[model samples]
Target chain A: MDDSQLKRRFAEWEQEYSKRPARACETLSGVSLKPVYTPLDLPDADYLRDLGLPGQYPFTRGIHPDMYRGRLWTMRQFAGFGSARDTNARYKFLLGHGETGLSVAFDFPTLYGRDSDDARARGEVGKCGVAISSLDDMATLFEGIPLDKVSTSMTINGPAAVIWAFYIAAAELQGVKPEVLRGTIQNDILKEYIAQKSWLFPPEPSMRVITDIMRFASEQVPRWNTISISGYHIREAGSTAAQELAFTLKDGLTYVEAGIAAGLDVDGFAPRLSYFFNSHLDFFEEVAKFRAARRIWAREMRETFKAKDPRSWLLRFHTQTAGCSLTAQQPENNIARTGFQALAAVLGGTQSLHTNSMDETWALPTEKAVLIALRTQQLIAEETGAASVADPLGGSWYVEALTDELERQAREYFRKIDALGGMVRAIEHGFPQREIADASYRHQRAVEEGRRTVVGVNRYQLEGEKLEIPLLRIDPEVEKSQCERLSELRRRRDGARVEQVLTDLREACAGTDNVMPLVLDAARARATLGEICQAMKDVFGEYVEPPMF
Target chain B: MAKRLRILVAKPGLDGHDRGAKIVARGLRDAGFEVIYTGLHQTPEMIAEAALQEDVDAVGLSILSGAHMTLFPDVVRLLGEKGAGDILVFGGGIIPDEDKQTLEGLGVGRLFGPGTEIREIVEYLRDRFSDRVAEETGD
Candidate 1:
């Protein structure tokens, strides 16, 4: 029989059988779910084109032919907090425990381009992530970790170019050349305006800095993934999966356009560009979202931008299990949540992964909780048979259908974004931010109305929940000591040289020149992150996000 | 008629995690409370000043950068100095129990953590301002 007969039969079966428990048949992204999917559901299911071989063009199944069978996903836990010395020790600890790569989490001050001594850095010196204020601190941050041996990913934006310069200088101190260094910088600034909101300069100047990095990285740090076009923050900030996929890819496309506008070849820089996504709670939806992400990217790069290189069509992403999905109630339950999410990520063919610690909702995770998180990934990679095959769930009718639907939705968003004159213009008018706020409010309302079930939150009620887990406490003395070190560096460094390099940086920011070399000079001259940023800020001015949800 | 229940929902410190604050602000708004949102990267001084100027019934400060100890108490003290000490102070974020207790000791009202129902915060505010709400709604 055909689709009509199958639909009739499905309706008859539905009429005869009452749905048990009476749950809403829908994904977390609010896509209405059908009871069951048949082959008829995929009307245009062209297997060769839509669901191609694992490593072929339109790589919907997987980016690599033998994804995990050849090599396991890099288990890079994002580790940082306190002073550079403190975070450096943690890196050694993680490496000793079998972690394959390094991911740095910079503190609030450093992320915002401030030294610990800046007035704005008060009470926040080493609170969120590791503090790296100068080349000295960067050197200390990776004192023993050989930059050439391990691939590192830094979560920095706004001032990503300067921080990257500091990293290169730090590596050079260890006798590592720039060409041999392998790492990624989270330099996607479009999302900062749209979701994360940790911006420094206005969009035009920010884009200028980014394009400079793209050109510089292709020549100098060829192995480095210039910008990890991110959806992690967008998802964490409460967007549905469709928005995250659309906005992130749109941001990536925007960067490609920016690169081309700056007179760079598409194939030149596109190969090194990577992606970052969130492995959220809805397992199948997330898997489909990832598959759809790769396919959409491959198609768009091949068709839209006329990218000739097949490497430009690939969408290699690093996945971090959803931090928002973990509940504070029954904190231990987060381990299981993270485990499932991590598995979904691997099944979706992630290139690398970060599993959030159970106690992250309360504070920065303690040592034990961090270990449990790392072990969660190890279990999936080594013990569980999930990673043995590429795209194990690629043939599932439900996943395929969802993949089609998500791609359709993302394309619809791309049209809306294009009509609004691209993502930057959309962001200027707060379109994406408003969309995320509305969706987040809707999800909250669903939970409040008992339409959605959050395991420990709305259901399985735990009364007067006392989170007894060991919490990592940032030492208050961290701020005090960090300030002392900053003052010491300032007093000892060549003040005239610092001022001269900063002046040169301001000129580079104002004129049509790549600011990377000057930024490296400033980093080498012992100019602080704050001072270097201040020099550019004097020319570009700081960004002030209009009041938005 | 009595004035509407006015509350200030603000993000303090450098961290840009504003999802919880914005949700709570809208939740309180939907619950018939007037919420003044301070957007992102708000200083404690700015928050206290805004609370005083707006004459909000309470100031709800959110911080997840692990600087709650420094930011929260500073906001409360500034409020007291500005002579708006009666404005209820409360918020949500990634605060430990011990820090919560100390903040409570410093006259900050009940704090909520992640996964808190928006209804719970709504009810907390409703209970705190029961007199005004009853007078306004004429219940």
Candidate 2:
């Protein structure tokens, strides 16, 4: 139990494990794992100052003291596919399955601001997620679900402002006030440049649009989270855990600076600013990454912005299990992988969690697959007793050491980004892209060289294994039906009103006027996604990526 | 003198997800292949015109929109009408095994799924291109 005895036991255990040579013990970030850790490893650590009580300074433990005891983290299953009617049915199905919240995944057309009837959207009307080209589709997508009661998160960028305006206008149609609407827009365009590559305008105008939303949301949508600055897609694009943390926080800093420059007080909008992260297979590293994120964010918000509100300093985030980690070979093993990942998110004090389905390596998750995925989170929350205590590994020597090391690495990245004139410059200069490429290359090398063992990929050689899991197949007819719906929508809406609203939207974009209200007006007029986006494009112009990436 | 093998890498449909297409474009370029990527949300017509204007030896269509069953065959059929069917046609995405087989049967040169090593695709194209040239020259 004492330090010397623990160290002696660790030495003997390491020697034994080294002799076996079968199971390699290491962090997913390539950090070596020792058999045991002691106080000597973390000497200058102040528990209260560094890893304080929940809701205290630095707030590494948690943002809330009674994290899940009062109310469990929302089991928000990200669901949407096909026409609005189909996605609406899926939403009700998920809600019936005990899902706590709704997360919308729009199809490519909606994400890229193309109407279902557009030539560019021909075969992709409702393929990946739901297709919402007009207010009619938005109204149908949330038909039975009450906008005021249930929280919704829309996974959209590029056309995030227009999509969010549609949601707000739809909420108003349902008699819900903007101040009472609660959810997230994922309006972080900066991350789209870093990893997702779904950007619309150039960086300067994009940040301007983002800041305008931040300011408008602060004034109107008090309960809504304006921007969920995401590191999830970045990590999914093959970034290491530290890169996910550092790059995501750098994005947060960029948004903060933009918001401050827009003449808003930091404390006014900072509390509603949330984060979305990837919970990969590396349990300890993931936990440490989350803790370090909170510590770094709290310190920056307080020291840099001189914020007086404690609420403004907290970094509340939602965690989703990494979709890229699922293996198509021996897909059942993904269940265990997701279980452990869910455990990590819970232990990391995620405010909400979504465990990816096992069959996602193939297609959109099926009903059976998503139910099991939801059960994975439920099992950890109810059976594992992890939710009993906040920050269960707060005092562990290994966790503390890992957290400190991760913070150091992340701050080094922060310093590098700062020297390169922040995240936008760094992205344009291909710094983050090159870093991610190098990390992805290192991971691929490890898997090939047997330095890291993927369960069924390299070490576990099960050749010609047949997957027993049922794959989800989208009906080809869904596209045809969605196309028909778009045709009917175009036929029904008043053409003159739509044209006038789009003209106003274009003129608003051409001036100093905020585009959010104009976008909302366009949504209300049932202007198609392509029409609205083209209006803005005529003013802001489309982005041409520099010869960097 | 060896002529450059120009290829138009297009991401047709509304799929804003371009990680795979971007990576493959980069990989092909690094493998000494000239690649002109007509960014996301390109129509099949736009892609065909671009391929014609670029005078590409091949056109690689990348669509993850689950629309490849209809989209891939359209591209091949359009290329045929435009008298460009001799250009090698290939595609990649989350296509089902059965669908890939169907696409291949319908004259698609190759169908790549996830976890495909970049080298394998590059080598296949190299050998196939030379074989086609040899047949044409009666060598």
Candidate 3:
């Protein structure tokens, strides 16, 4: 049966189907869903052009041919809270529980480039994540964990370069070579201005800092992924899957262009660039988004950027189950939600995954909840047969159609972004922010109007459900100990050496020299995170966001 | 004529999570209130100064970083020091059930936890402010 015969059969089926009353249906992104999908739905989709063989160009099926069969996706849980020592214990615990990689979540002060003792950092020290103030803290945080053995992903931006320098210096203390360092820095700052709102400097200077890391890492730490261009935060902030994909890829393109402008070879740095995406509850939609992301990145890298290496074209990403979808009511239900979402990520061929713990909506996850979250991934890998085949849902009529539709929508967004002169300009004009706000508001209204049903939120209401899950509470003593440690370090460190290195860092920031070396020196000299950031702040100044809806 | 209700939405301390705060701010604005949003990394002093300068009738502190124990009371105290003691202070974000009672006992108005409806917050403000106006006018 060729195209015409399939089309005739589809028309006959639709005629009969249309006679019956249709039920209202749509995806999470408001894309209208059909009662059924057929091959005729994707008549123009060329198999060879649109989705080539896995491990080939335009890798929509999967990046590697064998995908999970060759090696399972890393069970990298995002863990960090309280002081460095406390988080190190958590890291060792996760590793002992069969976790493969480490993903660090920094506290608010660390994320914003403030020391634990900064007045603004009071009460927030080690609250959301580990507070790493200097090389001393970084060394202790990774204490016994060999940098050469475990691949680490640090989720920090704005001050990513500085934090990364601390990591490099700490690795030096461990006698690990820079070239052996394998991990990612969630160093994508464009997403900061667009969604996460953790930005430190203005866009122009931030881009410069990112490009400098690209240049330095390409030479020194070839195995390290300098930037994890992220859509996880965008989706968490309420954008649809298509918006997250297009905006994130557009940000990647912006970084690629910046690298080229800074005189780096496309293939040299592009291969080390990675992505981070959110795996939400809409399983098929999330899978489709991942497939479309690969196709877009592959084509853009090979054609648009004229990259020669196949590694440069691969769209490797780390996925985390959606945190926003978790509910504070009937919290146990979130375990099922995270399991299904993690399965979607596995089927979508994520290189790494972080399953959200069930109790996250109220507080950080307790030991039991985080273990359940990690076990969710382990079940999908070990028990479920989903990982046996690459792109298990590939070639399904509904999935292929959804994948094509998502790519079409993302391409339309790319055109609009290009017309607006690119992502930075679009963000400055409040394009992505307004888009997310509108989508979020629409979804909220739907939930309120009973048009959509979240399992325990608006529908299937449980009256006066008692909270029973154990919640992780960071001790206020964590803050006190951290501040005391920071103060003691200040008193014991060579103050004059810190000042001299900081002046050098300030000079490096003032000029065109790559600031990584100077920052590494500052870290080595025991210059605190805040002191090094202050040097850059003195030169670059702080960014104040303009008002937007 | 009744004065238009002005509210200041502030995120105190070092938390960068602002999705809830932004959503509440927009919700209040859509409900016809003038909202001044103090962006991320705001200290208690900054929040209190913003509330005093904006002359808001209410100040809503959105903190998700579990620092509500320290930050919320500090903001309330600063508001008093700035002679804005009459300004209604409420809070939201990840505050536990036990802590909610403690915060309210410390003169913080009703604290909304996760899964709270924006309309409920809007309604709470409407009732509280109208009661204040009636009592002051000796209705």
Candidate with top DockQ is 1
lDDT of each: 0.92, 0.85, 0.90
Ranking by DockQ: 1, 3, 2
Which sections of candidate 1 miss by over 4 Å? A1-23, B131-139
Report the candidate with higher TM-score, 1 versus 2. Answer: 1
Question: What is the per-residue lDDT of model 2 for residues A1-549, given as tens digits with 9 covering 90 to 100?
Answer: 486887787678778877875754678887777767877688698888898898788999999978789889999999888889988998999899889999998887788788887777777777788889888789899998999999999998889888888888888889988888999999888888778767778888888888878888988888989899899999987889999999999999888898888888999999999999999998899999999999999999999988889998999999999988888778788899999998999999999999999888778889998999999988888898999999998888999899998899999999999899888999888899889866776676576466877878665858787668777777778878877887887888899999999988888788778889888888888887788988888888887554322
Instruction: Give the candidate number with the greatest lDDT.
Output: 1
| Residue runs of model 2 more than 4 Å from their true location after superposition | A1-26, A33-35, A546-549, B1-10, B22-39, B49-58, B126-139
Listed models, DockQ each: 0.79, 0.44, 0.64
**In candidate 3 chain A, what residue range of length 10 has the lowest lDDT sum?**
A441-450
Q: In candidate 1, which residue pairs clash? A: none
The sequence of per-residue lDDT tens digits that candidate 3 reaches over residues A1-549 is 688888888889989999999796889998899998887777787889988888888999999988888999999999999989999999999999999999999998899999998888888888888999989999999999999999999999999998999999999999999999999999999999888888889899899999999989988999999999999999988899999998999999999999999999999999999999999989899999999999999999999999999999999999999998888889999999999999999989899999999999888888899999999999999999988998888899899999988988999999999999899999888898889878887777677677988887787869988888777888989888888898999999999999999999888888999988998899999899999998999999998777544
lDDT of 2 at A134: 81
Cα TM-score of candidate 3:
0.98
| Positional deviation of residue B113's Cα in model 3 after best superposition, in angstroms | 2.2
Model 1, range A346-442, lDDT digits (tens) per residue? 9999999999999998888888899999999999988999988889998899999999999999999999999999999999989999999999999
For model 1, the interface Cα RMSD in angstroms equals 0.9
